[model samples]
Target: MESGNSIHQKPVFWQESMPELRPCHNRTVTAQRTYGGISAAERRAGRRAALLDAALEIIGTQGVDKLTVAGLCAQAGLNERYYYEQFTGRDAVLTALFDGIAEELASAIVQALQEVAGGSAADTPSAARENAANPSARRMRPETRTMAHAAVAAGIHVLTDDPRKAQVALAVSASTPELRSRTLQTIASFANLVAARGIDFYALSTPTPDPAIGFRATYLVGGLVQTLTSWLQGDIDMTREQLIDETTDVFVLLGEDLAQRLR
Candidate 1:
C-alpha cells in the first residue's frame, strides 16, 4: 500500500468479496427479457403456435407439397430462424399439427363420455345411488345409447368446428407416406382405447388377451373415420344430426352385441 508497485498488486480481499467480477467462461447468465408485457417463453410459444396455424392453412389449401420451410415461414409471417426454433423441418410441423388435432379430438370424446356418465360433482346423489344399485341394468340400455350419442356428437363437433383442421387431419394425412403411417398408428391407439373403455363400461367377461375385442374396436374406429371423411368430402349427403344418430345406432348395435357375446 506504501509503494507505487502496490497499485498493480492483486487485491485478494476484493477478489474474494466480489467473486462475481471474475471472468467465468462456463457461467451463462441468461437474461429473460419481455416485450409488450409478454415474457420470452410466452413469445416463443406464440411463434410456435403461429407456425402451426400457418402450416395448417398451407396444407389445407395447397397440400403438403407446398409446405416448405421457406413457404411456411412466409405464411406464418415469421423468419426462417423462427421456423427452425420450433420445428426441425416441414414434416415435423405437419406431425405436430396432426398430433395436436388428434389430441383435441380425443379429449373432446373423453369429456363427452364423462358428461354422459354424470361423473361431475354437480350430479345428484340420488341418481348416483340408483346407478350404483343397478349399474348393469342402468348402463346397458339408456346409458349406452346416451353415451354413444354424446361421444359421437362431441367427436364430430370437434372435426366440423374447423373444416380446415379436418382437412389437414384426414385428407392431407393421406398425401404423404409418413403421415399415412402416423394415421394408422393413431387409429390403432384409438382402437385400443375403445376396446379398453368398452370392457370397463360393459363389464365384459371377455379376456383382454382375446383378439376379438381388438378386431372389433379397430373395425369400429376405422369405419367411423372413413364415414366422417366421406361426409366431409360431401360424398355423404345426410345432416350432422342424422350422421350422429346413425353412428350412435351402429355403436349401440355393435357394443351391445359384443357385450352379449362376451357375457
Candidate 2:
C-alpha cells in the first residue's frame, strides 16, 4: 500500500551485483549473429523476455528494493548492454511487466464471458427470442453464476499456475509509485468494463444513470484485488478450489442483487 514520491526513491540496499562479462572473440560474434538462424530482433526480444522473467523473480523473492539493473542483467544471463536494447531502466521494465499481466487478466475474462454468452444464446427459449424487442417483457434467462464461476476460475488459475506472475501483478505492483498508479488505472478500467456488462445484461435503462452502479463496480473490483493479493501473499489459508468457489459465490450474489434492484 505504498504511495507518493517516496516509493520511487532507491533504498540503501540497492547495491550493484553485475556479473563479470565474458571476453569477446570472433567465434562468439559469429555465433551470436546467426544463433539458431533467428533474426537479431527476435534474439533481442527473447533476451528482453528473459530479463522480465528475472525481474519478476527478484521482485517476488528479494523485493523491488533489490531490483538493480546489474542484478537483473546477471540473473537474466545477458550482458548489461542488452538490457538497454529493450528498456530504458528498471522502472520501464516494471511497467511493461505489469502491463503484460493486466492484458492477460483482461483476456481471460473476455474469453470466459464470450463462452458464457454463446451458451446462453444457444439455450434461450423461443418465446424469449421472439419478445427480444419488448422492453417490459421478462424472460427466463440463464443464471449468471456459470459466467461468474468461469471468469473467476480463469483469472485465479492464471495466477496460481505462475507464482511469479501472481507476485508481480498482485503484490509487487503496489510497492512503487509508478506501478501503483498503473495498477489503480488498470483496476478502474476493469471496473468500467464490469459496469458496462452489468448494464447490458440486466437491460437497465436510466435517463440519469445511477451513480451507485459505478460505485458498486469499483467496490467489487477493489475488494477482489485485495482479496487475491492477500491470497497470493499467503496471508489467506484457503485452497485454490475453495477460494474460487467463495469468490464466484460473492460475484453471483452481487449480480443477482443488482438484477433485483433494476427490476
Candidate 3:
C-alpha cells in the first residue's frame, strides 16, 4: 500500500516543477479543442445582449402591452428567427427585460456608493476630523455628491429617459411583482442618498424605523410609479422634471413624517 501511494506521489511532486494545469482552464481549452471554439458562446451572448437592448428600445417607444417579438425584432434590427433563438415569446422577453433593468439599477446604486467612498484626499484638519467622526463623510464632497445624485437620476432616467420604458415600469408595477420590487428599491435608495445630503425627501429617522420607514419608502416609490404610469396613460400633465421634483418633495415630507411617527 505504501509503495503504491509513493508511485503516485512521485509524479505529483514532479508536476510541481512544471506549469500548473487548472481544471477550469484545462477543461475550457479541451472543450474548445474538441468542439472547435469560444467564439460561438461569446457571439451567442452578444446577440442576446443586442436583442435585449432592442427590446428595451421598442418597449420604450411602444408601451409594454403592445410589445411583441416581431415588434422588438424590428426595433432590434434582428429578424424573427433571431428573436426566436433568444426568447420564446413576449413573456420571456419581458422577464428578461425586468432582469436586465434590475441589474442596471442595482449597478447604478452600487457604483454610486463605491465612487463616493473612493473620492480623493482632503488637506484640512476639518476634513480629516470629519472622516474620523463619520467615515462616509467624504462621500458628501461636492463632486462626489453630484455624481451620486447623477447615478440615481440616471437610473430614474432609465425608466423615464425613454417614454416606453417609463410606461412599462409604471404600468407593470401593479401587475408584475418584480417590477414593483425593483422600482421601490431604486426609489428607497435614491431617497436615502438625498436624505444623507440633507435634501428633503422621505423618512430621516423614526421610532418604528423598520415598518414606518418601509411604508414611507413604498408610498414615495409607489406614488412615482403610479404618477409615471398615469402620465403615460395621459392621466397627468406633468413634464419629467416636474415629476422628479414633485417626487423629491414627497420624499422629504415622508421622511419628516416618518420621524414624527417614530417619536
Candidate 4:
C-alpha cells in the first residue's frame, strides 16, 4: 500500500474531516454579564468572545463532537440563549476556533525560528577574521542550531502548556483529516523553509517511491505532534528539552542531507 495510505490497512485522519463542531454539542449554558460596570454592548461582545474561547478550549480538549453551543455555554458560563446571538451553529464556532488555532501555530513557528536564528548568531568581526584565516573551517551560523532547537521547543511548549488543547490537537489527528491537514500544513510550511535551502526538496525529502516518502513525512509530522502532545498529557517521561534533542536527532536520521541546513 501507499505510505500515507496506511501501511497495514490502518486509516489516517478519516473521522476528523467531517467538520463536527456545532451549537448543540455544548451542554453548558452561557451566564449573564457578571462584571459590575459594563455597558450592554460591551457585555454582549465580551460574552461572544468568551463563548468562542470556551468553544476552542472545549474542542482543543475534548474531540470536535463535544463542541455544541450548549457545551460552549456551559464551558463559558453563558446562557444557552446567548449562543445564537454570536454564531449560527457549531460549524461556525469550529471555523472560528480552527482559524484561531492555525494563527497560534503559525505564530509559534515564526517565533521558534526566530529564536533558533538568534541563538545561532555569534561573533561578528573576529569570526569573519577567523574564517578568512582558515578556508575549510566554515563557521556555522550561531543561529542555525539554535533555530533547530527552538523550532522543536516552541511546538512542545505550546502542546504541553495546555492539557486540553494538547489532547485535542494531538490524539484527534488519528481520526480527522481536517485536523490532520491543518497540522500537516503547518509542519510542511516549517519543513519548506528548511526544504528551500535545497532546490530539489521534492526529490530529496524521501528515498524512493518504493519506500513511501509521503508516508514517512506524515509519520514524522504526526509523531512530532502526538509525541509532544503525549508528553503534555503525562504519558511520556521525557523533558521538553530532551524531546527536542531527540526529535532533532530523528530529523537528522531521516531527512538525510536536508535536515542539516535547517540546523
Candidate 5:
C-alpha cells in the first residue's frame, strides 16, 4: 500500500498544460444552445405555460382538490421535474394561474377604458349634443356611460370568452382556504385599480385614500366578481350583452351616487 504522503502527490498529467483539465465552458454553451431553434430559457418558459394551462384544465374541471403535483405533471404532458422547475408546489401553480387570469382581465378593461377615453375627446361634441336632446336620459354623463359600457363589456368578454379562465378565477380560486385568502387579497388589489380609475374618470373630490372612496371601490369590484360568479354558475340568468349592460348600469349608478355623496 502507498504511504499517506505518496497519495497526496500530484499525478504526471497535472504537470502538463492540459487545457481540457481546466473548467469546461461546454456546460454554459450547452445550456444556452438553441436546440431545434429553442433555447433552454424558451423551453423552460414553454414548460411553465404548459403547466399553467394544465392547472387551468384541472382546476376548472376537477376543482382545486384534484390539483396535485402528479396530476398537474400528467395533465401538462411534462415530467414531475418540469413541474418543480416552474412551481414550488400545487398552491404556487394555482396562485400563478389565478393571478394570470386576473391580470389579463384587468389589462383588457384598462385598454377598453383607454380606447373610449381617447375617442371621447373627438366624439364629445356629438355626445354632448345627444345628451342635450335627451336631458332626462342623461342621468349618467354620456362619457361616463360610454366608459362604463366599454369597461364592463371588455371585462365580461375576457371572463366569458374563455369559460375555463372564469372557472379558474372565480370558482376554483375560492375552493380552497389558501385560495380563498388569495382571492380576497386579489379583490383588494382590483378595488384599488377601480378607485384609481374612478378618481381619473369622475374626478371625485375625495381622494383614493379616503375610506369612503375605498369602500365604494371595494363594493363595486367585489360585488361585480360575486355577481359574475353567480352568473357563470347559472344562478343569474341573462344574455351576455344583458349582463354587460346591467353591470354597466350598476357601475355608473353607484359610482355617480358615491361621487355625489363624496362631493
Candidate 6:
C-alpha cells in the first residue's frame, strides 16, 4: 500500500524539467482540464434532472400547457440544445416527472408498511394474543392503528412535503391525454403492489384466483388517489394532521371491512 503522502504526490511523468520556464503555462493547462470536471454522462444526467425540476416548477405554478421548451430551458438555466439531448419534448419531461413522483410515493408507502409491520411484530405480543383469542379484536389492536397511521403519514408526506411533486403527480398528469394514460398505468402498478401486500398480510393462499381481491385493490388505490388530488387542489379543506388522522381511520376501517369480506 502506498503512503498517504506518496499517493497524493504528482507522478514522475507530470514533473517538468524546466519548472521555472513553464510553470504558468502548465498551471493554466491543468486548471482548464480539471476545473469543474465531470463525465459526459454525468453532465447529461445532471442537465436532465435540472430540466425535470424546472418542468415541475412550471407545471406546478402555471398549468401544464404553459410548459414550453424555451421557458423550461430558461428556468433550468440550460440551453435548448441540452434540453433536446435529454428529452424529446415537453411531454417527455412531463412523463418522466410524473413517473418519478409515482415511484417515490409507492416506495414511501411500502417502506412505511414494512416498518409498521416489523414494529408490530416486535412490540404487540399482548395485543396479538388478545387478537388471537378474539377475531373481532384484531382490527382494534394498537398495532393496527400504528400501521394505519404510519402508512397514511408516509403517503401524505410524499405529497405535502413537495407541492411541486403533488401538482405534477396529481394535477398536471390528469390534464393531458398522454400524461393521463401514464398516470393510469402508474396507478395500476401501485394497485398490484398493494394487492400483493394484502395477500401477504392476510396470509391468503397463493395463485389468488380471486377477481374481487384485484378489484378491491383498484378501488382502494383509486379512492386514495382521488382523495389526495382533491386535498392538494384545495377542494378538501383540512389541516395536514387532520388529513393524516382521517385518512388513517378510513384505511383501518377499510382494511377491517375488506378482511371480513375476504373471509
| Best by the TM-score measure | 5
Candidate 3's displacement at residue 184, Å, is: 8.7
- The alpha-carbon root-mean-square deviation between model 3 and the true structure, to one decimal in Å, is 14.7
Let me know the TM-score candidate 2 reaches against the reference structure: 0.73
Q: 54-162, model 2: which lDDT tens digit per residue?
A: 8888987877778888999999999998887677777777776776666677778878778767766434453243235322223223345555666778888877787
How does model 2 fare in lDDT?
0.69
Q: All models: lDDT?
A: 0.71, 0.69, 0.52, 0.54, 0.72, 0.68
Q: If both were scored by lDDT, which would come out higher, candidate 3 or candidate 6?
A: 6
lDDT of 3 by residue, 54-168 (tens): 7666666666766776677777677678777666566556655654554555556556545544654243443465445543444444333233344445556766655555544
* TM-score for each of the candidates: 0.77, 0.73, 0.55, 0.56, 0.79, 0.76
lDDT of 5 by residue, 28-108 (tens): 222245799896666777778788888888877887788898898899899998876667666667677777777676778
Better of 1 and 3 by TM-score: 1
Ranking by lDDT: 5, 1, 2, 6, 4, 3
| TM-score ranking of the models | 5, 1, 6, 2, 4, 3
* RMSD values, in order shown: 15.6, 10.1, 14.7, 11.9, 14.4, 12.3
Regions of candidate 1 where Cα sits further than 4 Å from its true position: 1-26, 119-140, 205-209
For residues 1-263, what per-residue lDDT tens digits would candidate 6 score against the true structure? 01000111222211112212235744633222222788544566677778888888898888787799999999999999887777776666766776667666666887888866765542666445535654444556566656666667887898888777787776645667876777777678777776676677666655643687788777877888898888877899998867776766666666666777767
The global Cα lDDT (0 to 1) of model 5 is 0.72
Of candidate 2, the 10-residue stretch with the lowest lDDT total is: 1-10
TM-score of decoy 1: 0.77
